[model samples]
Target: MGDYVLLAISCILVNNILLAQYLGCCPFLGTSKKMETAIGMGMAVIFVLVMAGAITWLLEAYLLKPFGLEYLRTIAFIIVIASLVQFVEMFLRKSIPALYKGLGIFLPLITTNCAVMGVCLININEEYTFVQSLVTSFSYATGFGLALVLFAGVRERVLLARVPKPLQDTSIGLVVAGMLALAFFAFKGMA
Candidate 1:
């Protein structure tokens, strides 16, 4: 139990997929303009990352390793991740049209989000047990959500602040992201 707690903390704060590792910046920047959209994207990522991690782990453990098919790992992981994204897309479109519309291109972009692929690969490469992989997956996704929400809050506030013309839009966003990354660095020793 204590080990699990430490792993969770390490993943969520010390080694955050977004803030620390810089894995999925595309959706991090694109969907972070509004708090609502950011929250929506965060939740969506959490769901997708967790499931992908579990399924990929199983695929690698039960199938790939047994048959010595390790070379196909990348292609297999891509197919699994893409299929899961498609499922989420269809479910959202049918069940929550508004959010589906809100997410727009960013939702599909989750398929390509490095954070998802990175976590899955990390789980396998680290040779974590099934439960450890699941925990790491959830923690990483939670960290991603936390960072996205925090950044969204900051970005929303920045909208009202007067800024130099040269440092507007993405320029200011990148600057703010750097500052946020520095803040997350404070958690490094906790792990």
Candidate 2:
């Protein structure tokens, strides 16, 4: 239990996929302009990452490994992740119309989101047990969520702040992201 807790914390803070590993920068930059959108995107990503991790782990252990299909890991994992995303999107549209609307375009965009795929790959490469893989996936998603929300807040403030003409939009966002990444580095020794 202690180790699980530590793994979650370390993954969330120390080895954050977005800030530390630099995965999924596209959505992190593109959808962070509005807090609402950022939250929606983050939640969508969390759902997909966790689900993708579980599915990929199962495939790797049961199907891929058994048939000596390790070489096809990337392609298989991607297919599963893409299919899972589609299923989730459809389910959300039917069962949670409000959330589906809230997520809007980001829902489909998650299929190509590198962070989700990255988590799946990490789980396979790390050879985490089933429970550990789930924990790590959730932790990674939490960290991604934290970063997205934080970036959204900062971007919101930036909208109101007086700034030079050149560094107003993406330039400022990039600088802010860099600083956030640096701040996250402080958690490296926590575990």
Candidate 3:
């Protein structure tokens, strides 16, 4: 239990997929413009990531390894992630139409987000047990949510502030994101 808790914390604040390794920057910068959209994307991503992690781990353990077809891990993982993304999309479109519309392309983009595949690969590579894989993936998604929401809040302020025309939008966003990444790294030692 303690190990799982520590792994979760590490994946979240310290080894964050966005702020730490710089994965999923597309959604981080794109969907993060609005707090509501960012939160929705975060939640959707969390669900997909956790599901993909578990499914991939099971596939790797039960089929790939047993059949000596480990080379197909990437393909298998992609299928699982894509399936989860489709499910999330349909569910959100049905239940939360507004947020679903707000998310737009960003939600589908989660299907290709390397972070989801990366965490699953990491779980298989590290040979994390079922519970550990789930916890780690959940934490990574939580970290993503944390960064997205916080960045959205800050970006709301950035939008209001007057700035030179050259750095009006994404240019300033990139700078702020870099700084946020650095700020997150400051906690590396604690984990």
Best candidate, lDDT-wise? 1
Q: Which pairs clash in model 2?
A: none
The pairs that clash in candidate 1 are: none
The local distance difference test score of model 3 is 0.90
The candidates, ranked best first by TM-score, are 1, 3, 2
**RMSD vs true structure, all candidates:** 0.7, 1.5, 1.0
* TM of each candidate vs. truth: 0.98, 0.94, 0.96
Q: How many clashing pairs in candidate 2?
A: 0
**Position 49, candidate 2: lDDT:** 88
Task: Report the lDDT tens digits of candidate 3 across residue range 1-191.
Answer: 88888898899998999988878888888998999999998898898998888888889989999899988888888988888898999998999899889999988899888788888888988889999999999999999999999999999999889989999789999999988988998989795
| Preferred candidate (TM-score higher): 1 or 3 | 1
Residue runs of model 1 more than 4 Å from their true location after superposition? none
- Tell how far residue 1 is off in model 1, in angstroms: 1.0
Question: What lDDT score belongs to each candidate, Candidate 1 first?
Answer: 0.96, 0.89, 0.90
**Which ranges in model 3 have alpha carbons more than 4 Å from their true place?**
none
